[model samples]
Target: MSNWNGNWESFARDAELAAKERLNEVDRISESNQWKVIKAFQKHRVSDFHFNSSTGYGYNDRGREVLDEVYAEVFGAESAIVRPHFVSGTHTIGIALFGVLRPGDEIVFVTGKPYDTLHKVLGHPGDGTGSLADWGVGFTFVPLLGNGQVDWEGVKAAVTPRTKVFAIQRSRGYDWRPSFTIQDIEEMVGKLRSIKDDAVIFADNCYGEFTEEREPTEIGVDLIAGSLIKNPGGGIAASGGYIAGRRDLVELAAYRLTAPGIGGEVGAMLGTTRSIYQGLYLAPLLVGQAVKGSVFAASAFERLGFETHPTWNDPRTDLIQAIRFRSAEHLITFVQAVQRAAAVDSHVVPEPWDMPGYENPVIMAAGTFIQGGSLELSADAPIREPYIAFMQGGLTYAHVKLAVRQVIEDMHSRNLL
Candidate 1:
């Protein structure tokens, strides 16, 4: 690609090679340490890859029984609603917010800004006239610290008796995108609840699942939410959203979805328990490997003379690390390079596109339409000038290494070495 040293092809190769070397080291932990805990909750595998719950539900559908098991396992909740409903991650956050609060009540988002989609779903006026403000409901945002941690003091100031929900987001792969552990949320919830007993501490738990030392629900979140397709579904669950919390909270969310069809948390396919089930089984291992890949890629990018976020050897991550290309053209071309390298499907092409709910026009090199930024199969990078986010999901960490190689090769082919 370059002097055989500077080009990305060589970079990707070296990165992938590094990943292979770590396989035995990482797999040992994946197969034994992580696998043992998830096996008790295992149902079955599907599509030669996905997991089906013991209750026989495939993608967390109409059957409430299996969802219960998943909730217990992931959130330590008595009940949960893990449905292939809610078109995307943002929709899921909206459902949880609506499920818990009344019109007169308020929701104090503890952790600063949410994911871009969630930011829009929460109805930011900056997104151009939509959302809770259009309706009678209220929404407020609390700023984070310089380091990106929550301004707990500000949260305390914002919480009033009118605050029915105090929400903290766990997934750190968006906005400022720095990973925070579940322990962070647990401690936040504890502090918030100590002040207000009736308030529900909520978590927008997205790409951050299975990487934490402890689950948020175990620590104290009244409700923990995320996309089943992202972390829990093991890169399966064609599409879905999940909410796990206290039993009453889950039931309340269900009622909101059913009531007047007020909340549209339902996806076209009500049942794919298989994909989600398998996703969970492969989850621990896939996540470990993905994290490992991130570490490797971050190091390679640093060596490539690019600014990288999230160091390569970090013990914990939300599963995304980005490098700055500094120019719009470079960002788009980089995305194209990675996509050209990753997917098996020839029909899928990488292109710049806009998302439905972001303030700025976010471009991505996505191959298919399973919601462009899906944390599956790889090769999707969202546009951030001077920065392109390379993320992975739904595939083995081994696959992530291959994708990294492809990205490096693509970079070399384009002569950006």
Candidate 2:
């Protein structure tokens, strides 16, 4: 590791030193969120018995029930559903949307277009995949202004009597923009409420979990959803997703997760209860580590003259650290270097391909214990102009630091840095 050539080693060290203040702030947020999780656990009386698995109809699954309570408490929501049954973040968000929306109801995206993976779920009319559009739940987005702020006038123009839900994506996703902070979401909730008091405000709380002192639900978000394997998983949860918010909205999502009469009551834990519980317990600190990694990456990349969103000292509301590259080759090199630094699957090389649920070919470097676990160090990018790679997650800050050094060395060797 000491073999780093040129200014790479110094760049890494200087980046860490430069980000000290911001890293401390991240720690404070983590500490607060940690206490919040512990309080929730204490309030719910989590126990070893709750870790035991259930089978068949899974009636009287105390573990599952308590897990829900703990999540609801942590997120400051009236109710929650934590289930491995929901496959991915996109799936979880889809369930939440489908739960409360009806034919003729419309969804207005006040935060601009959501992540690319959700496009298919939104679907085009009559596409026949049974998407929301196919079900007659119309959807449209009011693009953000040039400054990446919400287009309030555009949102007001878009809302109609049919606008039943207003969606907000808490993360930057693939966009080269700032991730919305809790305060930002609160302001948006206020603005949206003034326009349509009855419309449900939904937040896609994907990579944003535990990154702030308060969650979107704590402000005014009527519903929020996220994947356990991302932030809340703490690199321990094998698989799962969660939906939390108003009691009625949560119940509606639960109905969509299972059946109407058997909402959140009948799903078998299948022995995943323990990790899920422990994952949530560790999520706050783990999320802090990931956020620190993001900051370090931003600082280090900025020193190397690359463009980074949410620069080193900028406020962090999510784990993603997007670095724009000069070309697709540079982006690919950066992603491949991240894979090389992985403890798992270090020998495998990543290449862009037509990944499902994305319009563009994509490349990903995910060498995680759990497949697609972004909580572990990983980087991915869609092959498009303004080539950018979105790097997120690190179970340990040390690993993230090492990955940055490795990326710098590898890219420099190829003359791409």
Candidate 3:
């Protein structure tokens, strides 16, 4: 009753079998992270009353207050701000940067250029878009070494007395490089502290939460931000973002989120409190499932002689799995195959377009229940050379396996495999 040829079927079987040990490792991490989240919930004494929504000024919203406390405890940060008001991960990160840096201050990225969206946020000098550069905040980045490691010498040379913040991006974003591990961040923190103890060390934690036992905050990161729809959402949080780190830094970000006088004291949960709480409870296990899916994807593609970052057995610090393709057509077909396997919108095919905030057109295969939630099964790529598709997230390992099979079968049908 199967349509696959013997060779393709054998490839699928071999890929799964090869990923057994890595999958087991992912499960262990899930167990540990799940317990950590449970303990945070217990420490906060979370109750049904805390899920109640608030309206108007939301002056005394206990649910909102407790959510912040729970996130802070979970991330091992001095304080946190969790709110539905943040439109996206980029917005949350923008708030953190703007809140901390004054007009004359500068932010130096230690992990090479950040994801494409942030380029606009960084803006150009006097672009007049109210972006950082337009507002007089300086921005620059130290390119990573050829091996994808941080360029410490470049970082040292880039730093100035005006460098108020040093940023580290935990995920690879659209790049074909290895995501930074907690240990790597710890080392970077040490190096940066030695160079400039007063500078604030910030982390862009999107697509990276719950993937490891400890977060960047635990390793001395001064601030961190991420979207709820990514790993922390558990594929359930409808919309929101969170910022966690030092108490003063979090408060400053909160001020930017609302108003300076109000700060975190007033955000209405708007009936999303319950789902957000439950989502945090489920995040660890769901993230583990996604990571397992990424491992399987890596193995499957590597077996086909396609290059993969953080190969199946390589240590995974995030859910993203990048697979290189031979041509633009091959990349487009692969992404379309991912869309075909989507449970929500299999009938809707995706195409490359001039999506905002990037230099080139991008194709995305979401078809997720939560619009742009990457924590659900999705694939995307910018239409560029040495074409690569970045795939991430699956609510269950089974869904990912099915999608991978469909992608292979589709490619074969088109004589692409």
| Number of backbone-clashing residue pairs for each candidate, in the order shown | 22, 0, 0
TM-scores, one per candidate: 0.82, 0.98, 0.98
lDDT of 2 at 344: 98
Q: Which pairs of residues collide in model 3? A: none
Could you give candidate 3's per-residue lDDT for residues 77-138 as a string of tens digits? 99999988888999999999999988999999999999999999999888989899998999
Q: What lDDT score is found at residue 207 in candidate 1?
A: 79
Q: Give candidate 1's whole-model lDDT.
A: 0.63
Cα lDDT tens digits, model 2, 190-303, are 999999999999999999999999999999899999998999989999899999999999999999989898798799988899999999999999999999999998988888
Worst 10 residues of 3 by lDDT: 1-10
What local distance difference test score does each model get?
0.63, 0.93, 0.92
**Selected candidate, larger TM-score, 1 vs 3:** 3
RMSD in Å for all candidates = 5.0, 2.0, 2.1
**Which stretches in model 2 have alpha-carbon errors above 4 Å?**
1-9
Candidate number that wins on TM-score, 1 or 2: 2
- Model 2 vs. true fold: TM: 0.98
